[model samples]
Target chain A: MGEGLRGSIETTGLTMIYRSGKVEVPAIREINLTVGPGEFVAIMGPSGCGKSTLLHLLGGLVRPTRGQVLIDGIDIAKLSDAERTAVRREKVGYIFQRFNLLPNISARANIELAKRIHGNGHANLYKDDHILALLGIKEKIGFRPTELSGGEQQRVAIARAVINQPSILLADEPTGNLDSHNSRLVLTLLQDLNQRLGQTIVMITHDSEAASMANHVIEMRDGRILARTHHFVYEPEFEGLF
Target chain B: MTHSLVAANILSRPTRTLISILAVGTGVILMLIIGGITTGTLNDYLNRTMSVGADFILQPSGSTVFYAFSSAALPIKLADKLRETPGVGAVAPVLAKFSSADFGLVFGIDLATYDQFPGRLEILEGRNSLQGNEVIVDDLYAMSHKVSPGMTVEILGRKFTISAICRRGSVVRVFVPLPTLQQMNGTEDKVTIMFIKAAPGADVESVFRELHRAYPGLALVRTTDPSVLLADTRMPGLKEFRLTVVTVSMLISFMVILLAMYTTIFERTREIGILKSMGASKAFIVGLILRESVIISLLGIAFGVGASLIIRKLITTAFPTLQVDMTFVEVLRGSLLGLLGGTLGALYPAYKAARMDPVQALSYE
Candidate 1:
């Protein structure tokens, strides 16, 4: 883990309620959770489990009805909407399941958007051959999103998310639309990024196999955390005396 | 990403944008053509009606009802006396007579001295000779009466030959010899009015005072001043009618432009939203739309001005009497009016475009 990984994100008694006229429906209720920086965490839940809603709150895309979202000891709920958006733009990068890349711009331009939004000095800082070579998409930089395959588009989306070198990455079903092979490829890319760059990743997925790859797996039912399993893979070595 | 690219993108949707621009352009063209025609006619009418060459008009003062009805008249000796007055340059004695059959006034003037104030009368036939009871008739009167240059016409029981045809129009005048008019009126040393001229830079007021002192019996009516002549003649509500027509036309044109611009903005809502989502500022969007509108309007203005020039030439050639002077200032006024119409038309659309919210706009599809 990097030195910055000492701090993590925490949600304290978070509650989100949707109001329609006189009716009040709860999307999430009294959720408490902690995600360590640089840790690959997967949130698993069925539909209507508020997995995406929770991700939205953590990313500051939506405001919570109550409680606080803390990132590195700072409360995001206390900030204004514009300020929250700025914080999210600068600190959190999102990779959507559908690969929400602007259709008109090329693959390289998709990554350029993040740098422009964050007011970075170097627009082409991430346009280096190494980043494209790392993603195995160096040859497809000039291709538009429509020209690329589904897996290629997702790789570009991932590249766009990491181009800013954000402290935390929030992805909603990053591989939900892909085949098994493409899904494995995307997952391996996420795992490799976590191990090599110490990049934090919080992903929402339905597949248990995908969840098993994470350092921590969180399951939710009815907007409440049902179970959390922390696992560390251990490598076994042979003893010569034995 | 760059201003040029952004502008190019905004202009790339040629069909939709051109339609909006054409709406503005059509309105501007209509305004320019109508304004040009009306201004040209008004100027010509003013120049024609107000003849300022005649320095003075002699009329009876208090008891005299009109110049034609007056029994009192100025003697011919007053012309010689007015010539000797200070600042008086030249004096031409005129004998005024009326022809009841034509309801027109005749000024039997001295052919030798009539060159001082000809009053747009260009002799197209025989010379300006006042010999043998000959008369010069305006072209309008000659054409109406079917009288040629050598034809004889009896007026007030005196036989006279039409020596020449003067310029055309309803203010058709006939010039008979002064001695023949005296013989017809059966009076000697009798004249109607003395037309006078003053040297350049000579104050007409001082000249008028001296003329009035010299000829106390004659009224020193200063008809030479353009403003006084125009003021004295009532225009029979023609100006009001013209103003009403022009104002209503402009109002209709303005309404058309307003509606066109409104429709254009409403139709381009998606495009505007896309631009806003692309991080274009409110001012930038407004400026782009306004620039497009203004450019189209100016093009239309140029076309209208060019067309008007051709029309003016055609009209002038067809009717030589109609003097149409399309001045630079008038063309400038038309162009500026076009620009104003374009700006006014784009105001509402620009405001709507500027106030669009980026998020709502992006999701408008």
Candidate 2:
């Protein structure tokens, strides 16, 4: 793990309740969790398990009804909507199950949009072609999302997520829409990114094989943590892995 | 990258983009064409009136630039009195009437007396004299009405022989004998206005003041100062009429843009959600929408300007006597107003898109 103080997170009694008129439905109950910097954590759960909701909370996509969400040392739960958005832009990158690539723009444009949002629109600190080559998508950057396959779209989405070299990545089912062969390829890339960049990654998945790639595995049910498991994967160069 | 996104979004819906462009273009066209016609007609009238080389015009109190609207209220004796003034060089009495057939003013003047001015009618064809039951027409009106010397045409509901075809740029297109028009209108010995010239080396300002003092009850207007002639007080409801045209044109662009952008935001809800997840702020979203609208407005303005120029050509071709002048300042005003309306129209849609719930928007199918 990188020796950086960024990407550390902790939630103290984090709770979220949805209200529709007089009806109050709790999407997530009181939850306590902590993640250190440079950690690769996988959240495993079934549908309706609030795993996606938790990912959204970690990414600052929604405000919690109660409790605190701390990133590094700042409590984001107390920040205004604009402040939270700023934190998200500066620190968090998200990957969705459907790949969520804008259908009308080219793959390179999608990735560049992330850089623009992070206020590095005209900078060239991190080369994008190198990242696309690492993700095995350098040749397909000119095509729109609809012109690419599901696997190619997911690769572009991952490129967009990490384009700014954010401190944290919150991915909801990174391979849910891929075949088994593409799924393994995506998982291997995610693992390589986590190991090489030391970016704190929180991925949600239903496949055990995909979860096995993470350093830590967490299981959740009914919005509550059921189990926390720790494991290690063999470290090897990415030249022949895929 | 944001620019690419905006371009892709606009290009993706070709029909909607085109409709929006046409709407904005239509608004600009309305403003330019209507404004051009109003300004052109007024300037044409004022120029021709000034071209008569008259130092001052004497009319009844509260007379406007539009001589057709005025009655024969000034007595013909006023012309003799004006001619007798110390600085007055000459006075020509004109009884003006609106000719519906020609869509212009018809002037009645005594040929011998009207020949005293510098802009005296120079006959281009046939006899130069104008007498009872005889009419004189300018070259433009003569060609447009397809009449020449000795051709009989109707004027003031009476048939009169075309005695001559004069050069263009006269004060009026058609001319008749003063006694004939006076007998037809039962306004004998009373004329609509009197054109007065200053004697050589006479101070025009001093002459103007003398005339004003001599005729306290009448309205004496200096023909040299265009500003004085075009003053709002001199032209009733002209400013309001122009404002009405501009407001209506702006409203068209605003409403069309508002509807176009409103529908666009709803269609791109999921896309906006993706942007939000990518950490785009509300300001960024708003900027994106506004930028797209601005681009559309620019395209519309270019199209409108081109189309307005063509329409102007077509109008002038169809009616040679009509004038439509579109100055650069007028075009710029229309373009700026169109852009403003379009930008304002996108505000609500931009706000709605920026305020959308990211979670709900993401899940929207």
Candidate 3:
């Protein structure tokens, strides 16, 4: 897609280490990865494998202890905290495993809040009705997150994420809290969004079925990439995958 | 949408919101009511004193604005000496006594000498005679106590028949003959103060200066100006008392808002994380929290101002002799102080919320 050219992401030797007192623990270490514009990439890994930390770094949610995170050719790791926040506001949208909808406000308010954070400078490519209808949450936007089912809440969260038409979408197990049927619904919706909007998508998931929807899948272990594949495969070497 | 979020946050926990609002409102009320009473009593006393059209007042050295606080140290013979001074036309000797039962001062004055001033007591009912054991009550005092002409009232522990009801704007609500109050007080030749009036076409400033020169050992006060009369130096402990009341009132608002907003931010830790994850800046987060507090403060101010008005009405209705003034300026000052306290209280919590880590916050249970 021609729009994908502006959403490319690349990282060089990215690292994140969390410290408590004098004890330093590396969450992610020496990670080199790249995704072309509009690429739907899924990261598959076991728990504590730094999949979420990598996603957080990509979204500018945390400052990396070392290395470079390039979004649209601009390195965010070197930017100041405020500057990084501006970049995140203008170019990235995040979806959490729990949906992360502000529970006190209506779904519509949640979506509107993102637009407010993005500001009024950008010329939006899609209207609210088109996005809401595409995500099939136009009728559910009046309810608070607690009142909606898990799948409905995820749909609302997707609408909130894309309402500003950001260039990058980062999902930390977007369907982790959904049932099997809702999981398929959310995955198909993410696939549709990536394809229709030409937005680069980076998602972390344990379910292989969720990974199959992405154009590229990267498997991670101990904060390092163990395999990169174009299609989902239950390989023999990756046994005992609990 | 931001406003709705703030409103929803405040409305979600109705009980806590109500308690916070009430606390802030109570602070404003305390400020307005106590402050109103202090100012009202002071102004009322000073204004009534000035109403007598006296150019100057002579009292014992180091006397306060409250004449009741001063003993009868100025001799009644000082009236003749003051009257003989240059530019002094009339000198009225007044013996003032504090009446605990009335919560005011009782004044003893000679009817003939007091009438020489411009603000003479004009009789509205009964006879214009104040003699032995006969009291003259102002219209306000009469109405408040349901007393009228021919009614016997116990004043200063002595029975007195109401000889007349004067107009409301008098120097004191209760008045007795100068000789009678002096005899009862056991200070037959002593007086509390002397109200001196300048002759017609006489310069008041010259009279004031002459009085000051003539009574070098006594305190000479100009009675024409209210501000000069109510100066802090003349009213000992008045400024400090007002400041103490204001400080206590503001502390209530500050503490309530600090605890409320502090608890609120902790409860909304996850929501703050969500905002940060949505790319909200520190300023945006702080703005959200401040906006909520300002709204709460505004609501509390409105509640406070309304309640203060009602309380003022109740106080005056119950105690007609007492005055509590809640002027527009006082109301505005109270509102602004309450707002300031609340805004200050929210600062720490807002800072904490703004500095929250999105990663840790998102993962928080």
Candidate 4:
């Protein structure tokens, strides 16, 4: 259980292929990638370039057809499904494009559910309050997801993801559903937590502005990594692909 | 956290939840009311028979205890022979027939022979005589039919005046003269059953044993213990009836919950995916589904018990002859079976939810 918080990811020869009715379709193929501890990386690609597949593989949501995904020297690709779930539970948090907040429960309950899944029980209600405050959503904690704006629901999802203090946070188009204002607020919060809390984040987005906020940007095309860039100004090159 | 999540899930869809609850509740009601009536009727028959103050009741071998179903009649001369047995004090011969008009039995008993027992028919109103076209009715029958003394009621297509109204809880609610009923039925020398009483200081067990030896061809059933009366295997289809009621009740609970929870899981596919993505284990997902079912079952059980009690009271009040035994034990038993059915029903749905692929589930619309 002591899988500590120094999040370093290294993937060697990673590949994923879907097979259906005698036809083989490759989603991600032979992609070697690495991100240092505490770094914020963003992946940008057009549709079918395997950006989402890579993120799913990284978060252990889907098993790779071939390769090794080493998170802090532990290979999740070789682990059993249950063992991988434990690794995911212990180290990775996901922010989906749709928020995925349970609509039947309140924002506070959605956050507490992560703690419950993390096995912290009632011991961390005070800690959850602090996380809600950090995200500037303490007031809307009692409201259900149906009552919240897209931005607020994503914020609750973020609070849920990070409440367990995971080593890696995976964001799949975190600002995809929000307006310009909400997009800016969520991006700012992500960057704030990445820098101050030393949280490792890998985000996939079509927005160059959102990708520009990360410390590193990796561009993908045809199911492979095409280029990498450090924190730079938004270039028009990243905007037209998606 | 599990219970709260389950509660919130159920409360979110008020219409669906209520339908499930009501379906389960309806199952409970069927089990309680139908089963209660059957047992109640049998118990009432046994109690009234025992209350006749008879040590034993003699009937033909293999004759059904429910007199309506038993057409075999003992020869009236057998009563005289039974009276000659040592320690036998009195023997009352009764000729019984079921009247479709009242949906009950009409007993014809000799006044002198019936009055030999402690629960004799007390003449509450008109003359005690059962001479020529006279009838006796219980208070319940009198009140229900609105018949008073001297009112002529056609029984078996023959007109008879209500000569007396006796107390209720007797073997039969309606009574007629033995000789007249025998004459009309064309069975003057035959009787359905005989209530036998032992003389004072008589050893009743020995008397019954001796009578059993003498009347080896007949069912000399001892009525001293009420259990023996019910245990007599001649009562038609009682065991099968109870079993069918229980099985049908459980099937109702099982099928309703199975369908409700199965549909629920499919509707909440994306929520299940979200849970799985949040690192919820298989047991956690299963626990969530089963917890919701348990809550629904509990609500259904509560509704069922409350409804059953009200129904029992209504039935007993409106139809005084219907003895509905809604005992605490019966209620508890019905509740537990309903819960078991619900839990079992939810298992397949829970398993399906637990085994869902998170990637595919999250992709569900």
lDDT of each: 0.68, 0.89, 0.90, 0.87
Per-prediction DockQ comes to 0.09, 0.79, 0.80, 0.69
Candidate 3: where are CA atoms >4 Å away?
A: A1-5, A121-126, A233-242
Per-residue lDDT over B100-151 for candidate 3, one digit per residue giving the tens place of the 0 to 100 score: 9999999999999999999999899999999999999999999999999999
Model 3 chain B: lowest-lDDT 10 consecutive positions: B207-216
Clash pairs, candidate 3, are none
Best lDDT among the predictions, by candidate number = 3
Q: Give the alpha carbon lDDT tens digit for every residue of A24-136 in model 1.
A: 98989999999988889999878898898898788776678999988766678788755666667667877777776666567876666555555653756445555667788
Q: Per-candidate RMSD vs. true structure?
A: 10.5, 3.5, 2.4, 2.1
Give the per-residue lDDT of model 2 (tens digit) for B117-188. Answer: 888998999898899899999999888889999999998789999999999998888999999999998999
* Model 1, runs deviating above 4 Å: A1-8, A121-129, A195-198, A231-242, B2-15, B27-199, B204-365
Clashing pairs in 1: none
Question: Which candidate order results from sorting by lDDT in descending order?
Answer: 3, 2, 4, 1
lDDT by residue (B1-365, candidate 4, tens digit) is 66568889899888888988887888789889988998898888888888888999998888867876676378989889989999999999999988888878888889888999977887777777776799999898899889988999989889999999998877888889988888988998998999999998999989988998998998888877777778838666888887788788778778888998999999999999888888888898999999899899889989988898899999989988788887788888999988988888899999999989888999899
Compare candidates 1 and 4 on lDDT and give the better one: 4
Candidate 4 is graded, for docking, as: medium
| Sort by DockQ, top down from the best | 3, 2, 4, 1
- Name the best candidate (by TM-score): 2
Model 1 Cα lDDT, one tens digit per residue, B1-365: 22332344335556644554454445444544555565555444344323425567665554221244454267787777677778987777777677777655676777776666646357787766766588888776776677888899987677888888877542226778888888778766787666677766788889888878876875666764545534433233545764564455345434544665566556556546434332334565677567655665665566667776777788666654445666787667656766676667767777777676543443355
- Model 3 has a clash total of 0
- RMSD (CA, angstroms), candidate 1: 10.5
Share of native C-alpha contacts between chains A and B (below 8 angstroms) recovered by candidate 2: 0.80
